[model samples]
Target: MTESKDVNAGSTASKERVAQFNQRFDFGSYAETRQFLDELAELSKRDDYYPDVSFGKTYANISIDGEGQAALREMNSTFIADMQALVTKTKN
Candidate 1:
């Protein structure tokens, strides 16, 4: 299995800790929410990055573990931006 990109590959002692970034997205309906999730899954597959996600009928809460190396942080930020863009496209 492929290792998670969010993890620091260096030794444990030298690992850098960062804060988590959380966001909640409200979708129009359950169908829209699922569609967003599907898009997220595709994005994750493409980027090899996946965040913690919780969802209800019309909402999804995303918690990205931003704690890691600098490259990981950048990846997380980009992932968040892409997710936001996906939501915007879904709403339009």
Candidate 2:
């Protein structure tokens, strides 16, 4: 999967047009990053929508690519929103 510098996520139409969800985030610390990854792992298990996650130090790069376009689009939105929530939660 390719890394995207564009932080502005496209609309649902763009998600439908693409076959993958790619985004990068910074969690500020190793511990915070680990917490974020743990949350993601649990989410993947619960939703059965696994993603490609790479991280080091304080940054994480995530990508999910597979079959089922509809499911993928939904998962993309869900995952991104949850991740954003996690970031907000951690900040507070």
Total backbone clashes of candidate 2, pairs 3 or more residues apart or in separate chains: 0
lDDT of 1 at 48: 80
Q: List the residue pairs that clash in candidate 2.
A: none
Q: Write the per-residue lDDT of candidate 2 for residues 1-92, one digit (tens) a residue.
A: 44444554454446546556667888778988888888888777777776777889999898765444367576564755776687778656
Return the lDDT, model 2, position 73.
73
Model 1 TM-score, all chains together: 0.72
Error of 1 at 13 (Å): 12
Model 2 alpha-carbon drift over 4 Å, by segment: 1-19, 66-69, 73-77
**Which candidate number maximizes lDDT?**
1
TM-score of each: 0.72, 0.65
Cα deviation at 4, candidate 2, in Å, is 16
